[model samples]
Target: MSSYTKLRVAIEKPFGKDLSSAIELADSILGNLNSKEVFLIDHYLHKPGVSQIVEFCRSNPLLYSSAGLIDHIEIISSESIDVRGRTDYYDQYGVIRDMIQNHLTEILTLLTLDLSNLTSPSNRPFDLNAAKFDILKSIYPPFLQSAVFGQYSGYQDDLESDKGGNAHVNISTTPTLAIVVLHLQSPVWFNIPVIMVSGKKLGKRETIAKVVFKKTRHVSLRKKNGYCDDIVFTIQDSNGSSFITLPSNHNFNLPNDKTWTYNEGDGTSCSSMKTIPLGRMALKETYASVLRSLIRGESDLFVPLSNVLESWRIWSSLLLEYEEGKGEHLMIYNKSFLDNLRLTLNGSTLTVFVNSSDPQDNLVSFEKDGISFKSGNKTVEKIKEKIFGHFLYKFSRSSLAREISQDILDTAITSVQARDSFHLALPGGSSPADVYQSLVVDYKHSFPWTHTSIWQTDERCVPITSRDSNLFQLSKTLLAQVGVPYVNIHPLFPVCHKSESVLNEYASINYFDYVLLGVGKDGHTASLFPDSVNSSFSPFDNNETVKFVKLPLDYPIKVKERVTLSMERLVKARRIGMIITGKDKCHLAHVIESKDKHNSSLPFVQLLRKAKPGTVKIWMDRNICKK
Candidate 1:
């Protein structure tokens, strides 16, 4: 007998009210297992549920089967008034009834029994068909008066079938009805049965319990059972047939009689059969076969596993990157390190650590043989002159400005056209007001405005009409002038009206193709103010496309609740443009343009660092150059 001793049950409710009731029901049923302890988890709280279940299973190891137990139950309740005018709240249960009847437990028990039987082979070339028939006969004795199979059409159907093969059996018991299919020719042959054992309405079709099995050949018998030789398994399922092959040298282990043990040399072992959704199982099996071919050796496994492992690593890195106060550290890293970083693609926003500091002034660029940090600056006066020359004269030229502006516009247009639908996060404040106007005028005549959607980069908690609200400026400058339909424009609703819902609704749309922003003297852009309550605009560590922030600021013009597209969305954009003008902004611009890592303290530094290569273009005027 297996020394398993823990019971863990997971229950789901179709509605919130039924959650507690389902838990109560599960506890009652689990009580019958005679385990020392029972753990009932409610799925509504996903993380807590999984953690608690895992913890309970880990703590109690002797009362339940070694194999884990997961129970899913859904309950739907309704109420109605009868013809007599009396109102009644009727509780209707569907899958919940299946759970209470211990259907899952029974299925798991049967699976365990089947697995145990496969491990020890019979000496007399066990007739797979005969074995199935014998088991059925013993379980459903036809001569016994109280036998559950007495009323069912058993062997007659097998005899009358045109196939002339006894491959099917239908059984009806007090609490269950099922049809079992048996395949004798396959090495991996098992009874695939669809059982319906619920008290509620049967609905249109029968609920099923599908059992699948595969046989492993080339059984390797080793002293220590280290690794198995390539084994071919014939998979038999309710829907169809397939095959699974494991690498000959792949290291895998199965639980031994008293403890978990790994096979040393060549050994035969069955792969753990996972009961997943039919579609997923099919896909996994197909992929498994491909993996068997791909894994050449221990070193080769690293190639594929690396891809998988990198995904988790990226998540961990992102979490560390976004952890409060770690932004500065992430921004200090060089480009090569950032490029090799991996990240998961779950359609959620990802927090990126950007080195907002200028890359040109770094010690490596200055002292390194190949690159020089400052080509024109040997003294303070020369450095100041170069800053003034570049920011004042070079950046302000109409020719250069127009080139960058056109690049931004062209990229935005191309991206929107490619995606069919695109959103634009128009930042609030006077800085983007002119850019928005320019885009409106330029694109109105050259592009299809109808296909484009617009959202504010950030909004004040005040009404949309408020002067400080980004939506107000955008509406007056661009959205009001564009030919796009009203549905194409998503404006953040004022805080009084329900800001969260409004933000969520806007976030549901695809990320913007272009986000035009302006640099502030303090290095702040959009509504992202450093050390402000609105600083919540920081990119999320996950894959969400947008974020709503409530940044706090000391400056009157900067303080406000805002919603901004996350950095993940910004990086994902086809293009992003940062427009910088005015002499007061020169210091910040120069900081970002410099190679000093200290400059990363600026927010824009972070933005530039996190941006995908070639996606971001900084537009500046000579007047903004630092002297």
Candidate 2:
């Protein structure tokens, strides 16, 4: 770029792997050249089908104006073939980086762009980037809870075969398929989930952007749980036809369906549009279109550096997480997984598809309620117990530490084996110090500290060196001796405001593998005091994963201010162990469980009610049972 004064250079896809790198790369280029001289290329934007998505809406403006009524949007890209030839490249950049970060994000900007401010597409370079930038700025980062990743059953074989026959390879966690849900912060599109799904192998080769409107009030449509007719932009079809699909009941619509397809045509009237014959569209050649735009200095189609950086910011944590071998478990899927998959989002409920590649056993689907299996395996059933319902284990004081430590180890090892990582959250205070000590003394050598991340469940707002600090106690008892990498230890910052970033970081963790909690005599867990309800310190009933609490000066606690995980967040763990040791605390736990409506306000009771049926396992000393 520095070589010429007024030359336009087309940078390729994937400007950088993450936000910092994107900024660095952009600065290096823009320092020598102005913004207009740089054209960031993403060929998907130039595809005639993708381009027409904007045109179709521009022609029919009601769809864009009624954006608030839309339920959700889905941008789907599926491939029938595996990444055999591109194995090397595919290994480095998984589905999210290869597709969702660039191609799908560009399509999203076009589909949801606010065109009301701009008069025409003719005003390209300035108008388009501004509109896209607005949408990008309004988007929240992708949350791990709303994502599902999968790899084909034989992906490892493909990787080895691509290398020499004798090549050694570790089991790869790289996902060939991923479905991630993104939310928009813009009031016009508030709270609507923009679902981006892309995957290779086991599905038809199809690329489409589907806009599903909210369910109508009409009795017939509501009875069928159907929403307003979906407007689908078919970027590529099995037969290579590209068209915008409109709802139609006529025989001429589709081969055996009811949808009128419109292809690219120069006409002010919608009737003038006609579908092109399959595999015969001049606009299908995206590379030619992009190159033509680059040479002609038409910067409208090119991605700007701002868009690249924003997209990177949205996906940077996920990319960094996986690169560090800390990501959601990559589900092994059979060849027919995608073919049998069905996704339905109705009202506030979404049903997700889950499939397993186990040859001897078959797992079906996962709904909001729980996982469904066609056949049962002993091991699978045991694991399911740890996730779905509540169980109580009463152990003597002697066995409490040993048993809980073993349980923690079991979960950590299982998580590492499945996802190459484990995330654990621990509560503070003197109650569970023995458990922490047992973990370090007995199982430190066997634990996968290298692939584990330790998070504080709650912390006193005092300095880290203070005696009241949770990190100080944790370090003294467990963390210092475990030999876990310093990078894996996540401490809640003493500065309450600084710890809010934990929510963003936690967004990339699917679930804490195991969370060790303690209930006080006041029926509070994780620094969530009973009397703090409705105060600024109340961490209940919010969407935040981490919260800051500041008690009044007269409060009895030594350190009045604190940072804690919300009850909503604590329930997201795969397993929750409540360790109640003292007689007074154990009595409070029983009273909380016994009193039905009267104890409803208690945080411990609230946790039991909010948690999945089998997820909360109470581990108590034998004294509770004896009493």
Candidate 3:
């Protein structure tokens, strides 16, 4: 910043940002070519945590030699970038040139470099540009094993380059997302594969590097509900470190089942390594140290041009191959890069938790796949809208849940503003539990609970204390966390298997304010199933809307039978929210008759047949939408 020229001038608001005080501060660091500073860095290197860890790695080489770095390294970072800030700069460079090319690459180098060979700025060799050359060398077969790129559905919708937007037209073809895997052939990283993942308009902000040691033998019990049990190993400069808390099995209580139980050779715990607490201040401190090196005329923190040029040369060739359709090895990202849906402590792990409080307003429109129908409440308007059916496809279930939580909040707010008590019908099953847990962590406080009432759309014919009960999940996820008075909760089928009694009881209510539903692998919603219509047992004949159809003794689900709200009443709610996740049930979605009254064997299809336009919505992840 010493020799950089500063432009001083004040202009109008918004459009004249070049004259702003922030712009002046940023400009002060530019135009310093004649300065004695041997290295220059963006603000990312100035984070306090980055500097601390890098400095630690530099000062203590013995620990790394003993414990050893992971053979495989993975860095994944993504954020939902807004259109207003870097709209113009992002168009041509996209995420690859803007983020992956620089910031991500820097983090990768900082993590893997052999610090013993590096020295202070004054004693560094003149050929510092060759520092990373060996690390970027191509292996025997090839260093880049695979690569991928993607563009979100509506990326170009807001672009009008003439007004500071990118010359964006078609979004499907452009690369707004990129993931690259490199097989390095260095002494420290021989046979090690490093993966870099980055993108724009993703689910949330995330950045982390994971190193994986190959073939380490350890026993692990598969975590329940498809969650992973992860373990981390730390090497420090003789200081203490604290490992993160691992998740426990929520449904079943067990004493001996620790999720992250691991072993260290020679019975030495790695807990005594010196470490800083993980958070923002540590990152800031690291960045400040990097800047200090440059201020003192050091090139130790700067990336060599040789390393950068090789990166560009390799990626450019890959881009050409991608354009010619020859890059089949490049895998497209079907899931959110920000989702840390894995369990491990080594180099391949990312930040393991989804930030529940991220705003859900990124709901832009994609290509229209709508189901046209005559809007009405008739029993057999012969409905079930198809094509898109107001479906929202997302890569992250946490994001899907985040978006849905807002809808729930909006529904409650409308009811409160109208001076009416909000009535909500909740569903059972694990599919909707992620959304429920997210609501508890991020959305519960904002809801108008005093004006809200909770009701189950369906439940098991057992005590509420049973693990199979839907009320058990609801109580654990939301009821225990929020102040939604106990009197406002309504449980169905709590004592016995009297389905008709609860059905008759619900008949007195006009309609539910909002409803949350989930689909089974069989494409069933609530207790409705394929081939469920009984000729001798019609709800209309019994004058009861709910029916308990006897299930075959050999049903796939362990539950003998499930009590559910009839499809007729389910569609009558003001908002019908259905969440579909995982790839297995995706086949069921394809099998569903999206056409009008083209009755299929699936109960979901039957329910859709009667669903009115704009009343129902199905939110699914990309994998579910993929063939």
Q: What are the per-model C-alpha RMSD values against the true structure?
A: 28.2, 14.6, 24.0
Task: Name the regions of candidate 2 deviating beyond 4 angstroms.
Answer: 1-5, 67-69, 120-126, 214-228, 249-284, 321-328, 346-349, 354-627
* Candidate 3: stretches off by over 4 Å: 1-395, 494-504, 532-543, 592-597, 625-627
> Which candidate comes out best when scored by lDDT?
2
lDDT of 3 by residue, 1-627 (tens): 122223222111111111233234334533533223224354454443333445444444542452344445566666565443455656645555666655666665666666556564565453423545544443211111144456654555645543565464444354677666554434565435566777766666545455444444221211122212221212111222222212232122212222234222232333222223433434455556655655554444554334454545434434443454433222233235345223222332211212234323121111111111121222211112333354443433434665566567656756665656888889878888877775675445445677888888877766778888888988887788887889888777732355455556677667888889888888778877677533122353354546555467666766665566777788888887877787778676566524433557677666655777667677666456565
Please report, as a residue range, the 10-residue window in candidate 3 with the lowest summed lDDT: 364-373
Ranking by TM-score: 2, 3, 1
Q: Give the local distance difference test score of model 3.
A: 0.52
Candidate 1 per-residue lDDT, tens place, 1-627, comes to 111234322222222123244345445654675422222222111211111222222232331232222111111111111111111111122122223222232222222232223333556432322222223222210010001110112223322242344366332121111111111111122212212122221221112222211222111111123222222221222333322223433332322221222333323433332111112134355445334323321111111111212122212211221222122111112213222222111111111211225433322121000111121233211111222122211333332333333444445445654676656666766565556554553344444467767766656667666776667777787777878789877775543244556646755665567777777777777655565324444433442654556654654554456555556556666567677777677677567556683446566667777666556666666455555
- The alpha-carbon deviation from the true structure for residue 343 of candidate 3, after best TM-score superposition, in angstroms, is 43
lDDT of each: 0.36, 0.69, 0.52
Compare candidates 1 and 2 on TM-score and give the better one: 2
Task: Spell out the clash pairs found in candidate 2.
Answer: 388-614, 389-613, 389-614, 389-615, 390-613, 390-614
Q: 558, model 3: CA deviation in Å?
A: 1.6
TM-score of each: 0.35, 0.58, 0.40
Top-TM-score candidate index: 2
Counting clashing residue pairs in each candidate, in order, gives 39, 6, 28
